[model samples]
Target: MSERKVLTKYYPPDFDPSAIGRTPKHLRKQGPKVITVRLMAPFPMKCTNCGEYIYRGRKFNARKQTLEEKYLNIPIYRFFIRCTRCSGEITFRTDPKNMDYECEKGAKRNFEPWRDSKSGKYNETEEETLDRLEREENAEHEQQERDKMAELEEKMHDSKREMAIADALDEIRTRNARIARNEGKDDEAALDSIHEQVDESLLQAEREDEEAARKAFMTANGERIKRIVEEEEEDPVPTAAPVSAQSKPAASISMPPPSSTSFSRVKKTKKSGNLLGIKKKPSLV
Candidate 1:
């Protein structure tokens, strides 16, 4: 907790705002709330010069006045207890709040004597004006520092925003690159598929050409065999013709004697399908 600063003003014993109309005149003065009371007690007082004991309440007059010291908050009523023996005066105060008497001058209070002395000594010169000016300068310096801190904070915020924007731009670039890479990948896949389709079409064309060549060769071989068979059947062997052979020589003509093509054809027929046996010739035809 922060300690409150004591104001530089002297307050007497009986200033109380709460007791405005109810307090007595002695207790309603403009001062502190505590007061000290003094009594003329017939006590023995020792003289410091002669070392003689002097009885109090003698013809030596004692002055009872409140001593407004620098440190004491409550007005200390110093009884100048004088001794008629050697004109020696001993001063003491009665503490009214504690209801105790103390001979010691040094008492503890919230008021600081050093601070009071400093203020008093400075008030006597031009140093008070300098102190006020210094206080103003310190306040202005603190305000400047606060402004500098605020400016630095604003710069930091701007920097953070710039960094965020830069990061967003970087992310956008990355996304675009990724999208372009995906497009490239798609294009590559499509090209690969197109190349595969072309290769398949070429392979199919080769297969079709192969089949066509095989079929054409087979057709040519069949036509050549048919022509050879027709030529061999038209030219019969020289022999006496039978009556049925003279009427239909070409129909009754027999095939030529077995060569390589004929034997292969006969073997292919036997290998390929079921065949029926021919009837035996009756005569030379």
Candidate 2:
């Protein structure tokens, strides 16, 4: 037991080191370098050999090997895993272009809804994609044309509205101008009529004044003549002296007798009032 625990080992003095054989070159260069690594499944898959389902994140001792194929100078790697139930070999490789993995054999990758939706290339052909793009372009063009037509119609309506508003404004301005002209004419005519009425009233007042003065003067002269006639009749006349033959007969001065018809009295009527400082006399009866 002590000897087994000892660190040093005994060797024969006649041991020969050159008798060991070396590995053959043909076997060394036969295949790619394969390394055993512990890894988790990247995606879920179903084993084709046994129809057994394998979920993601399952741990496996996989053989990883670098292949000659490269994408943009980056090395590609292949992984070999075995199904747990049937021990069937499953192979998958890294896809650098798509940044995913592709199953080569012995298994079928499960459908990933998120990945299919993101790629937009699931189960669709090239012709179907072209048709879909063409339909979208046509729909966008039609929409653009409809928008342009709507804009044109809106512009036309705006122009028409502006024109109508301008016409209405013009009509209103003309009407206002005509009304102003008519008002000015009416004002002038009214002033002229008022002046004429004033002048006519003045003329009528002058005629009334002249007639009143004439009637007053005639009444005064008739009264004076009647008084003189009364005085002559009341006094006796003296006898005249005899005229000599030497003096021609002096012409006898004669006066006309006063008559009632020589002057006529005027009748007066009631009047409203006097104008222009003229006073009216009271009526006798």
Candidate 3:
């Protein structure tokens, strides 16, 4: 059978980690003093090399060293430590300007620098004052431009309205003049058409009258010739027996004068009109 070995350690309640025994001055100046602090609360951290988070209240052996550089004329102290996981070098220091400790470069801190700057005694910075003045100047210039535009608009409104009215009136007058000219042209054209129609009608009437006169003359002559022919055919006329020169007058008187109509009765009427209003059919030929 194998036996388990046991080990034990003892300490007193008055233990102090900061207590140091007297040491030689030459040895103290040569190296930085290291300390272990208990974190009151959790702090979130990330390792640069391993990219691991180190939770707050974790123990670390850190060397404390003072830098010659200062912030706000106050000496700054630095803590040098190695990451617990990757042993990556990290450095941090107290920041008096922001009233919070800031990570110099190795890692990031979540503290906001402006938090302490907004105290009751805070004053406006030079940049902030200049930005305010520039804003005011720009606003003033814009207001002046708006005012100028408003004044110009007020003046232009009346002039534009008057010009628009005048233009409308001119357009109306021009339209009226053009319409009058067109009407006059139409009237002149109608009058010329009417005159042409009247002349045509007169010429037609003259031609018709001439044709009627010729027909009437032909009919009268034909009737007279026909009657003469019938009478000669019906009764043979005895040649007047050699009437002596002395009996000539008596023979002419004895024979009744041949019948005839007067020249006036046979004349064709000159009047032309549609007295009966009869519709005559035109010859297709």
Candidate 4:
């Protein structure tokens, strides 16, 4: 171990360094540059050489090489792997256009339902596929144009409806203002009429009170005059003493008492006449 680790080594005194010969350039190996790599299977496939199945994600020691073909300037690479069961060679290459791998020889890839569905291919001719694509694009453009026109028409209709609603609101507000003003005038007139009626009623009440007072005064005055006349009729009148003997003898000659007829006549006269000197018709006996 110590001799192997040493940087310097012993040499024979008789050795000659110039006797060795070099190979010619034409005799050197020539081929495409290939490199060994570790990778997993990209997809499930079956080997044609040995009828062996290879599943995706299986690790392998593969030989990778750059290919002559390219897609849109992107380089494509080919890989060679051997089957695990029979050690048969399998070749596949990168497909940049589809972003997937393609089997070239020695193996066949399994069918993929998802890939077929996405490509929408049914083994149709090239011309038919092109026509279908063009028709689809035209239909899409027409649909977009129709949508834009419909949106524009809807906006115009909304603007017109809004304008009409605003006009109606303005008319309604103006009418309401006019009605309010008229109602105010009517209220003022009603107040004036009510005041006039109250004043008339007050005047009528005053007139009635005055007439009632006058009638009461007349009734009281007439009652007082009637009482005075009744008192005078109830009292008897006294005669004066005879001044001379002849008058004494005349008074002594018992004058026949005044007749009841004469007293009745005075009473009737007093009752028939008033202080105002108006005569009343005699009452029936």
Q: Write the per-residue lDDT of candidate 2 for residues 220-248, one digit (tens) a residue.
A: 54542233344445566778877665565
10 residues in a row with least lDDT, candidate 2: 223-232
**What digit string (tens of lDDT, one per residue) describes model 3 on residues 125-221?**
5577678779999999999999999999998998999999999999999999977866777777867877999999999999999988767766644
lDDT of 2: 0.86
By lDDT, the better pick of 1 and 3 is 3
TM-score of 2: 0.36
Estimated TM-score for each candidate: 0.24, 0.36, 0.27, 0.47
Q: lDDT (0-100) at residue 91 of candidate 1?
A: 64
Worst 10 residues of 4 by lDDT: 223-232
lDDT of 1 at 6: 55
> Against the true structure, whose TM-score is highest?
4
Q: Mind sharing the TM-score for model 3?
A: 0.27
Q: Give per-residue CA lDDT, model 1, range 1-285, as digits (tens).
A: 233565565657987667666877776567533333444544444555566654444443456666666233666666665444555556666665434455542212233355365556423435665787799999999999999999999999999999999999999999999778767777778679779999999999999999887676666445422333444446767898556755776866787787777546443334322345565566975
Model 1 is weakest, by summed lDDT over 10 consecutive residues, at 103-112
Instruction: Report each candidate's C-alpha RMSD, comma-separated, in the order given.
Output: 32.1, 32.6, 31.8, 30.9
Scored by lDDT, the top model is 2
Q: Is candidate 1 or candidate 4 better by lDDT?
A: 4
Scored by CA lDDT, what does every candidate get? 0.62, 0.86, 0.69, 0.84
